[model samples]
Target: MMENKPDEPVDHLSQLPVLRLNLHELAREQRTEQGQLALRDLTRLLSALVAGHAAVQTGQVDWRVRGYTHAQPGGDVQPMIELKVSAVLPLLCQRCLQPALQRVQDKVLFRLVEQEPGLTQEELEAEDEALCVRVAVDIQAMVEDQMLLALPLVPMHEVCPQPIVVAGLEAQPIDLPARASPFAALASLKKGK
Candidate 1:
């Protein structure tokens, strides 16, 4: 039998689950300036997200997010988080098999869902049809996902201007005829005879 102890408090915050912020709420909670969140506060929130393993890596991202909320035709509230990201990311070059710097400038649009319970399967399915937000907007995650998606699968030079030669393998020489075929000599002999 498992005994519940009051002293051993469970981390309810962890269990509280991730909530998607209503876009409208996010818009309303904007920082003093327009189109930007406080860098310090945003960094703190980003750190939490990074710690939770929700984002890929900290040092690689540089971007901003502009969020807004609006009511849909059916009266469902939705948050739209728009991200503008630009960064120089290191990726493996397919041709050279070496690490290369890739400049990325891209945008991503994500929809936020409300956190609610007691909805039936049909209702949940309907909500899913709508933009569902599994986790609150973490700027880092948004930027990282967008940048990763924008990057090319194989990075290489378009024209491959440089000449490449593999160390171990050398070019094979083409074979050519050393002398004329016997048929040609026979034809000349027949003409003379």
Candidate 2:
């Protein structure tokens, strides 16, 4: 961490500005933007992190976004945005219940669309791991959303620092009587006849 004197002026260049990008304009002009953000500025993501963990101790985020259009076979141009983000997040390990540092990375290609008949664009995000968006885009919120999704379902270290024992009943193998085959019932009926 860089320390500044009380009298020193702060440099704001490293700080990212809030952006609400117009997806349509971006695709038409094929624009690209890249910058770094303070994790403290990302309220939602910051709240998700484990408090007082060294992994996310620095509190930083890196992001890049590019927009372009693709001409479909029918001469319809489709707006698209390619987004990439990466960050080291602190999370509670499910295995040992300890603070685990997890690197979350996400590269997504979003097909921008207008309103669909019945489907919500947010709901379409989970389809086949692809992303879709409509209207203007809030870059900050988008980054948070993608980052959250990229987080591991169960965060854990490959090898825990130490083993942890919990009080629980040991699982024992169960044996059950096998059920007769469907044909056995038919055989029984025929024999009775």
Compared with the true structure, all predictions reach lDDT values of 0.53, 0.77
TM-score of each: 0.46, 0.67
RMSD of each: 12.6, 6.7
Model 2, span 8-97: residue lDDT tens: 977553465668888678878999988776676676776778876765547677899888887889899878788899988888888998
lDDT of 1 by residue, 1-193 (tens): 9766988966443443332344445554642111222222333333322233312243345666566665789996565666677655545567875545567677655555465545688765642323455544544444445665677767765444456678877599668779988999999999998
Number of backbone-clashing residue pairs for each candidate, in the order shown: 3, 0
Q: Which stretches of candidate 1 lie over 4 Å from their true place?
A: 1-24, 28-60, 74-77, 115-131, 134-136, 159-162, 167-169, 172-193
Q: Give candidate 2 misplaced runs (Cα > 4 Å).
A: 1-16, 120-136, 167-193
Worst 10 residues of 2 by lDDT: 126-135
